[model samples]
Target: MDKSWIDWADWCSKPYRAKLEDFLNFAYVNRDPSSRIYCPCRKCENRKFFEKVIVRQHLHGNGFWKKYKIWDKHGESRDGADSLHRDEMFMGSDDYMEEDMVKVLNGWTDKSFKDLLDICNESMPEGVNLPNSYYQAQKLTEDLGFTYNTVDACPNSCMLFRNEDINLDQCLICKASRWKEDGCSLVSDLGPGKRKAAKQARYFPLKPRLQRLFMSSKIATLMRWHAEKRTDDGVFRHPADSLAWKDFDKKHPSFSGDIRNVRLGLASDGFNPFRTMNIVHSTWPVILVPYNLPPMMLMKQPFIYLSVLIDGPKGPGDKIDVYLQPLIEELKELWDEGIETFDASSNQMFQMHAALLWTINDFPAYANLSGWNTKGEYACPSCNSETASIWLPNGKKFSYGSSRRFLPYDHKYRKDPRSFNGLREYRRSPTTLSGVDLLTQLQSNGILTEYRREDLQTRQMMGLEKPEKDPLKKRKHNWKKKSIFFELPYWKDNLIRHNLDVMHIEKNVCDNVLETILGVAGKSKDNISSRRDLELMGIREQYHVKRRESGSEYFDPADFEMNNDGKDKFLIALSETRMPDGSASHIARRVRLKDRSISGLKSHDNHILLQQLIPLSIRSSLPKKVVEGLIDLGKFFKVLCSKLNCAADLEEARSRIVVTLCDLEKIFPPSFFDVMEHLPIHLVQEALIAGAVQFRWMYPIERCGE
Candidate 1:
């Protein structure tokens, strides 16, 4: 041993004999002080013989002491050099860590990282250290191909505070502060004009995430499955195999030429994440789903990439175009210029082209993105034909209160031709204009105007559409003539840009159905006219019981007898219900189905009513045709919720629903065809034409929200 090593041993033994003994044990050293063992540590590298002194220097070296302290702190037996062997000290740690990781992965949003760490720490024994800090845990997760890219956003929610806007003092549109002016969100002191980032939005990019998908051999194989694995024997194995997708490909051959290229569907909706209806805060998250994967895995939350988040107190509404600027620019680059991307499965680099196949959103979001007012006189986006709406007494809003005529205008329900009073007109436009023509007509001065003459001319034909009554009245009739959609390099056709989401349409229609059924509105099931009709069907029960001083029934409506089985089920669903607090029941009162008064039903309650209860309770009481229509509607939704194999199945289901709803026009009250209800029928028809599969349904997202 060297003389310096001997001196170092003498120095360590004077102050740290206990530590030296621990180190000697950790290095598996012999007891004899003179005995020579080869030093296998990285510093000495086996060239130098290990004496007690040399081992002490190596363990106590400035570079090694910090980790040695950690070893000591954790009651670790091995020295820093033997870290790989530290696994022995951490016996059962892998299993424990894996269990913790599952909680992090599954319910990430449920608890903050610090809270998760605190909980984990609480479970561990005293002196037992965790594997990583919260930030280190996040870094480790990122290394595992899951993480977020956060970017600062404008406080006003006008745009993402990045690129050119990064240096901007205030938002150009809303003129809101770019930083926390009051120093509330800042960590450091802000003096006068100085500021810190006030608001931030998490953005997960498509490129790296898509590359990560390719990294997994299983997913990479599935990504190419749409083109290679699918059978092309006149069956809908994929959306590309459907007629609508094929037609689009035929129209734009260049886009469809590369079968390996990815196709994506964009969906966004403003939802109150706070979960309180009274507080109107909406958060719009834009999700991009790769349709290249199989149906079963396509819409999974983990698989779907979040492209952007539009923070909101109020939803961006039509101004959503402003916030979508970054995404649109990136999409344009992906489409026109393409990006150099590597496929880990194939082990090759290629120029990747991604196409935005279609946007899926509700009517309001559709109007915002597509620049067509969904609440216009011609509310039907597919046809752009005249629509009939009636002013509701209770709602205080005009609802499309008549059955929409199909494009051909051949309908027995049309009671008026020139007047178009009871009959909704079906004047489908001669043709849908290309995006180029639309842009030319809209942006006459190189900037999007509030309204287009062509659109106004079409609206002129509708009697309800006066100069003052243009539906863009919400924007004071200043509807942006051009939308961000017009700028999409790939979409030359406007008709196909926005897809009608079946989910939102169904929910809205279902809500209306529930309101109508529960007597929540005057135009609904409990209406005087409908009650009279129900009473005629031998379905009368007592209601509006005005108790006299003698407690005798006065002004009783139940003049007819009720059927046993139907009345029993109907009464069970509606007769007496627990109060909101669940403390007591509203006394079991005998009430007619038509005279039922109930409110505050949740979305799932509506689902239960539509899926199982409605048909069972209402069938025996209403007219035969009305009963049949309601049963058919319920059956259709249940069928949709079942296993569907192909696009043909969707088309068949849509056709049956349309026919069933059309047949009920005379049977149901006019309010049943309110715009909310009318919209879904057309949306389903459009989805059938577009060849949407079950994976693209909005129900999944809404269910996720819940």
Candidate 2:
């Protein structure tokens, strides 16, 4: 080989070998003890004290026995092996790096080709990396840098790992230790207490819908702190500052309280009664359905989400990240049918506050004339007269002069006999008026055109109107209560989680609930058998305990609904009422004959009667006590009904009649009439209506009057 080619082969054939040999040569040339000053450790000194041949023999494991143990007091891991309480900080698997790797290699030059640049760079570019990106990369490198955030003060709230677009609450207790450095959270000094607590209650795979609920809860609190309210004077007139919502949200501050949390409990045990009823009714945008939650979840709808915000010092962590997707998808389904969600924020709960103050319950304003007031009209207080629209409501109509921008309109109240000063005494009049139109048009026999006929008819009808009635005349109907409805559309995806359904609580369900119960009953008992939330709701009992400290009633589904497949089968009502409504008259005992056939009755006209048989059993793969409890529902409802208020005849309540079967392998008392206490899902009709009517109450009159 030529000289140039020979040198090239030597240079290319060895890479790792070259690097190692080069370092070895450098070490040999400077063989003094001081030359091993790269490290002051004993390990480095031992290697330096020995010559190259001895070191090479020891490293190659060629019968050069010097196998002394090296103790890692700090438990530092250099290679990829992970120790129990230590971390692997370096990639130390480079010991097998091959030497002479270039000769047979086709890509040696290409692999290190970065050593060749399109153009030479004499110096580094200034500020090549951005501060934000650099810091962001650094933030994710260490566990010491990690922090857990709380969604709310409640322990039941789920937790998240970091800040994101959504808010998924992470268990504050488990994450307390990660936030000590921020001076924002009490991350240290808590003997792993929070970690164990978090382990006891944690949600995996954060969901989006739940995340939004966490943030929404925070917003609800701020809204209650600031809202404009006025007393209801029978006259329906309010002061200027009292009414301002019409245009305020447009320029709201950064801390605007947009999320309104008109909260009720959100758990199966301490569930909200209002939302439970809505789920039973299959109301659009109201029944929280998931993206693809099975029909089973649709039956036992979950309750309202609780929105809470911590008021004091942050107890343990950074801002809790919570997921909000699961809930959002459910809301979208209602729009398919054109439904809406209600802004049941704290602002709507004014009646209670008003009652305490002994002020009017509500008040509103009614302006008659509004327009860009010209020379004969008044100018806008904010902008000059040129820009505003001019229109008139009934009361102030008389003072309003003609303007090019004004449009006249009237409501039923405008014709009512209520006078506010002279505001009530106005008439629709523009002085240049002469109503009598006399038309003379000769009809052409061949074709009396459409325009000519229309003109003749208009002229003939100019003076026609049912004569005006006196606005001062009082109308009795005004005092009578009239039914009004408003449309509210909200979507939810919490169908299966509602404790009432899973636990077999029927007090809040109506006819619709009964129907759903029966439908589920029609299926095999092997389905829907495993829901632990059911046991907490009293579908099964483990010795009833009265816990005064927590204000709770306890039951265990494990005692009954448990089946072989690991499902809790609570008792279910076999019979159902015919009317299919919340009314007490609709309650019917679902009859599952001893032969396992569910029964009900229908008259000769095909109208369902009070009795019949349907083959029904509470079967579930999960095998929980709640599923088994369905078998003895009559006894359960009787005991439950005995404790609840008498809404209607318990015998007719369809919701009470449908049930589950739990506790085949256990024994318990029938029903405790002495301590027969049951709770209602919703305490007020108005609140229940609001939850159920979300998008369905589309009638404007049903909504609260502004």
Candidate 1 Cα outliers beyond 4 Å, as residue runs: 1-131, 141-149, 181-189, 192-198, 233-237, 251-255, 276-280, 388-396, 401-404, 407-411, 415-481, 521-568, 571-608, 635-659
Q: Each candidate's lDDT (Cα)? A: 0.57, 0.24
Candidate 1 matches the true fold with a TM-score of 0.66
| Position 69, candidate 1: lDDT | 30
Each model's number of backbone clashes?
0, 136
How much is 226 displaced in model 2, in angstroms?
21
The digit string of per-residue lDDT tens for model 2 on 1-706 reads 0112212223324552354344345334423322221211224533333445544333333221123222121232223232323311111111111211331233444323323221112231221111122233223232222222332223322233333512323334333322233245443334444422221112221123332222233333432432333223321121111112212222233212332312111211112223444443210111221211111221122322222222222221111112222222222332222122222232132111000000010010000000111121222211122222222221211121111111133433233221111123134422211111100101111111111223223322542111123121132111111000001121011111111111122321222122333333433221122222222324333343435567754433323323323211212333333554542233244344333333332211011221121113344422345334433443433333231222233323323322121122122222110000111211111112111111111121112110
Q: How close is candidate 2 to the true structure, as a TM-score?
A: 0.18
lDDT of 1 by residue, 1-706 (tens): 1113322434345445554555566544322345444443446644455565675667555212322233322223322233423332343354445755766456654346557666776786432344445565555445545566666666645566677656666655446667665535443245545656666666666666766676555777788877777767665445656566666667767766766568888888888866778898888888888888876676787676778776666676665665666677778877787777666566666677777877777678888777776764556555443454455454344545344344335654443432223334554323444456656645553334222333333444443243366444444222434676656765765336777765556655666664554435453443554433333322323332345799863543221223444445555665544436653234234235554543554444555556666677675555566567778887776655554345566667666766676665544444356566665455444445555446556656655544
**CA displacement after TM-score superposition, residue 306 of candidate 1 (Å):** 1.5
Report the C-alpha displacement of residue 235, candidate 2, in angstroms: 27
